[model samples]
Target: MTIDLEILHALSEAFGPPGDESQVRDLLRGRLAPLTDEVWTDVVGNLFALKRAKGESRGRVLVTAHMDEAALMVMQVGGDGLLSVRAAGKTEARGLLGQVVHLGPSRTPGVIGVQPVHLTPHERRQDLPDLGDLTVDIGVDSKDEAAGVVKRGDYAVPAAAFGRLGPLVKGKALDNRAGLVVALALLEGDYPCDLYIAFTAQEGVGARGARVAAYAVEPDLALVVDGVGVDELPDEDEPPPDVRLGEGPVLVLSDTRTLLDRGLSLRLQALAEAHGIPYQVLATRGETSDARGVQAAGAGIPTALVGLPIRYPHLPVSLAHPDDLEAAFRLLQAALSQPG
Candidate 1:
């Protein structure tokens, strides 16, 4: 299968954060409208595209991916041109010391500020700054000046561009953007069932968008695609992540809070085995996925999570392999080529 790297690059670099997905939503709407018979955005900002079957419809299949990424939101502007910020998703303040963010719709450039290490007492140098203590510097000299360029509730995301880095694609928001691109690729194939492609919102803070979409669609089967990064990686001091990058798409059996439908999960594995698609079993114990909301809606629906492992997850520089991306697209295409 020939995967389109250009789509990945565009999506990875798009400006999107939790509770604010208009930028990414516009991009998806334009790209998906021509491919499907119907495309529209719902009340919660979830974008849905539907393509009907050629003949008699067997069943409806809903494939979903979240478009929102973790980011920083402006809370207050200080008198000294300092913009106070907070995490928009699960992103931490530790590795964000020297990061850059583009503020609001204007995309004004700014940097997260910190005290220079040279001035710190030698005994207290190892201490990390709290997220609440960090501020964004937008090159202004006073609070009113800074307010003219930025206001409270303005969203800021890392000013990272998606590009090739040796063997992997690197940029911000690879976690779920990678999955969204893969889902879009599946539209190229024909299927016996009617297909619904949902680009959901607010998945970083919680599965808020997926919850409403699942209930609204009410399909017989649902598949959630995620590009969640590994919690920990293999190293001299730490054990390997439960799932590894470049291996294949992950067939999520269960997450920290939800037990996915066994029948569907096993069916995906069977299809992968039959098609010679390299796959992995992700039994993560610390992170919750969109499955929680999808599986618990109304009378309960069968669901499975098709995941791709990202290197840094929520940071501005998440990395993913092209091989794994193709595997995900092919697996979804072949699995639903005929309805189960």
Candidate 2:
């Protein structure tokens, strides 16, 4: 199946920071309602779409894609109209300086500001600035004015556009949006097992929504569709990245918090190879995803992770290869079609 550009554009451009995923959830729910038998959400904001098996169910199968992205939260509004912020998840202070952001539910425009490098002390100039050294300037002149636009505890996301760059797709939050597109596509096919699609929330924070959704669904097998990062620099050295754009979808072996089901991972790899779909493997021990929570829930679920490699992940805008995106969809479709 080809990628749905309209859905990809909508999901990529929607603002859905950790713990605040209504925008993304709404998009998925509307698309999934017509394709699934049931669509519902939990109190913590996780969206679930279920499509029953065609006949006797082989088993309950679950596939998930998180709805949240790295973001910033306003900690305080300074008297000068600047907003002090803390990272909500994977937001990096180094990438935020001077970056444009949309704040709160209103999507008020703002730009992150930092002290001029030319005026900073020489010794401190080389030091990396932390979140404390940054402030979001909302083009206001007083705290009251800023308060009228934004306030303490409001969330902000990168103000970025979604578009294709040659063979690459560039946009904010491609990390999980790419996965969402695949998960949405899977709903189009009728599988042999009860299929559950979870558009999880708060994944960037700590996979909070995934934990609850896993326990609720209690699928015999779980697969996490998400984004993995690439380390393909022009001059990059040893410990080279195992994942890369255009290469294929990633079959994650292990990450910081989760060790994927080896049998499930191997089955996916075999399917990809047998079907002529390109695929890759990643074993980074420092990275994590919703599988972290899903694998440990309810006596244990056999969980596997399929990832689309992203460039400049967790930044304002990231890049992904459209081919990799399609490969992921094709592979997961094959996996779901197999009789367990």
- Candidate 1 lDDT, tens digit per residue, 204-233? 888888888889889898999997566655
Candidate 1 stretches with Cα past 4 Å from truth are 231-234
**What is the per-residue lDDT of model 2 for residues 124-228, given as tens digits with 9 covering 90 to 100?**
878878887788999999998887889899999999999989978899999889999989989989899999999999999888999899999999999999899
TM-score of each: 0.96, 0.97
Clash pairs, candidate 1, are 175-227
| Candidate 1, position 120, lDDT | 81
Candidates in order have lDDT scores of 0.86, 0.90
Q: Total backbone clashes of model 2? A: 0
Q: What is the C-alpha RMSD of each candidate to the true structure, in Å?
A: 1.4, 1.2
TM-score, prediction 2: 0.97
> Which one wins on lDDT?
2
**Candidate 2, run of 10 with poorest lDDT:** 234-243
